[model samples]
Target: MSRTKTRFAFVCQSCGFRSPKWLGRCPGCEEWNTFAEESERVISGGSSARPAVPYPEIEDLSLSRIDSGIGELNRVLGGGIVPGSIILLGGEPGIGKSTLVLQAAEELSRQGLQVLYLAGEESAQQIKIRGDRLGLAGKHLFLASETCLERFLEEAQKIRPNLLVIDSIQTVYTESLDSIAGSISQVRECAARLLRFAKGERVPAFLVGHITKDGALAGPKALEHIVDTVLYFEGERHQNHKIVRAVKNRFGPANELGIFEMTGQGLKEVDSPSQLFLTERAPQAPGSAVVGAIEGSRPMLVEVQALVSQSNYITARRESNGFDRNRLSLLLAMLERRAGLHLLGTDVYVNVAGGLALSEPAVDLAVVAAVVSSFRNQPLSAKTVLFGEVGLAGEIRAVSLAVTRIREALAMGFKSVVLPANNLPLAEGVPKVELVGMSSVLDFMEWAG
Candidate 1:
């Protein structure tokens, strides 16, 4: 009997970079003190290689999607969940990741689909308590408290469930690698095995992933590449509403947004997000402007609030929430150079109401309007909405989907729209709204006065 030789190497936890020896800084991810030693058994000799097969025809193959009974979730998933797809849901701790998955599982089970939920961090009793609290009957929802990937797969093979959910990928480990559960090798290997199982069984799987302190998924970067879709929960945990944004999706469009309200029962889908965001907005308030923004295919109305105050120190402070700080600085420079709003001695602050992040350039005009309103202590009309991109030359540029944005503002009861002069022709057919077109930021300042 020959003993197997064990090979050891240091691996970076941030990325799956391997090294022959340990170093203070990782050359792959450029992070310090992130490498951990891992070992694997060295197998000798090679087995007979299998021959490759020809590819099968997939043009005539049509897939039927499974509805999770959640409209917002289905929309984020590109209509419905595709079979054999692996979906990774990541969020900060206590951000309702488990609650959302359990609710979806309960709904699937209610529709006569057997759902096997493997809870790696919690026990069966804990999951049961959560389910009962969520008012789930759990007719066909099977729960298993297991962290070993091999045994869990064995049980899954026997059950042949329609849907599979792993409470978390960080806590599950495979025995083949001599590493801890949350280590890079273990997480990567377990995720790979799960992916193979899902593809072979043609069953859709949901993976709950933990996030790092930097708000990224806690695992090797390759974990995200292995999944078909990635959904992230965004918002403060103390808040009642949460935003689910799809950063990556293979079957559907990316950057899709879903709104949900946390209730005593479970996560409730928000149908009218624009209304919810504007419910508590104060009318006739200075420093506030409404912007018609589009997230994926859904058009929404969001509030952009800005505050301009004299700085106590010699250097002015610039801070922004739910909006890019660099963009704020650029906008401030443009305002000072073009609109003659002397902001060098004042501190500027900007925030997007309802914890919704606005990355689109169409909100530029609204941000500028809000800042001007705050600086001059004047309030714009509450029924007016703005959307257009501002260029470095003080020109208002036309944005995509102008008609869609106008229609959303109209539906939200906004009477007037301030848009780029070029987009007026695109939105000319929209009825019952006053269109105020601006060719440049100077024109906007004239309109504001």
Candidate 2:
């Protein structure tokens, strides 16, 4: 037999660039002294067992999906997994990214789909030990502990499973690509091959992606553009709750989010997000207030907390977590200039409880209330919820979906809602809920006092 042709490749380690010949500087990205060697290039076979079928005379215009039984995950995936779709899932290290996918695969396999989970990081026995703990027992499900793309493909073609999951893409190696497995060139190429296989064979594939030090999907920026859906697992790992947010979805709305609480039984859906927000609430605490913010169509009532004390240093130690510090400073300045808040000697600390990052300006009014409540040693009524945008002029400005926010508060048994006066008429005959409108932040303070 003729010897298989092998070519050399020079790859940059820092920038992840691959070249046929060694170079002093990388042409793709300017990183020095990072070039490495590759002996052979990955090759894609010019063959397929299945032939493409022509579209029928009857137009197929709608999507078809079988539920994965996880409502939260389904919502993020644009209503369950679509056949032949490839999803790129990324999260910080040790953030339960692998666990969530593995659990979903087991559930799908039990639902009569031929599922195959190929793990490059762990062996088959290792997967089973965890699976046993999860009580995942399926007769039709198959597990492979291989990492090479060629061997995985050979087994995949033979099995022809309905659902496929590669534990991670970075650990997978392909001889067709002349670069390291996790290199930009290799990753992009491997993903392209798998995507083709998915589309051509009508197999839904889930690939776990790694995040870089900068907390973005690792590999070339182009990798993000290629995937149909990108799901991010976000949360403080120590926290019981995990938020899977859909940063990009071709089939669903971008603002939709999924909430899962990690437990002994595995990740369970949090049906009432409002309760979860108040789980760790400290009642009657100064600088603590309930705020209703609308995220997409969902309304959430979250607690905003702040701490106030005398400043010793020249800089008043103004800091905020889960909320923007710059915005916090601006709000403080507005309070001083527009609302007459004394800030020359006071230190302010603010946090959005439960490790959530709140960027919605609707929380502005709440932040102001919490800070003032702390400063004045007062607490907002537990039965009340506040919603409004704070302007540079200290105006209690209007926020979007104010009516919806009020309705959410009402549904959560809140008796009154503080809102902008501009939001009037109240969604046509809403009853039993009091709406207190304020024109300025000072007006709100007086009402609170």
Highest TM-score, which number? Answer: 1
lDDT of 1 by residue, 307-414 (tens): 999999788999998889999999999999987889999999999999888899999999999999999989989999999999987899999999999998999999
The number of clashing residue pairs in each candidate reads 0, 6
* Ten-residue stretch with the least lDDT total in model 2: 213-222
User: Which segments of model 1 are wrong by more than 4 Å?
Assistant: 1-5, 42-56, 59-62, 220-222
lDDT of 2 at 283: 64
lDDT of 1 at 64: 80
Candidate 2: regions farther than 4 A off: 1-62, 212-222, 312-318, 344-347
> What is candidate 2's local distance difference test score?
0.79
Q: What is the lDDT of candidate 1?
A: 0.88
What does the lDDT read for residue 334 in candidate 2?
Answer: 93
Top lDDT: which candidate number? 1
Clashing pairs in 2: 13-34, 41-176, 42-175, 42-176, 42-177, 43-176
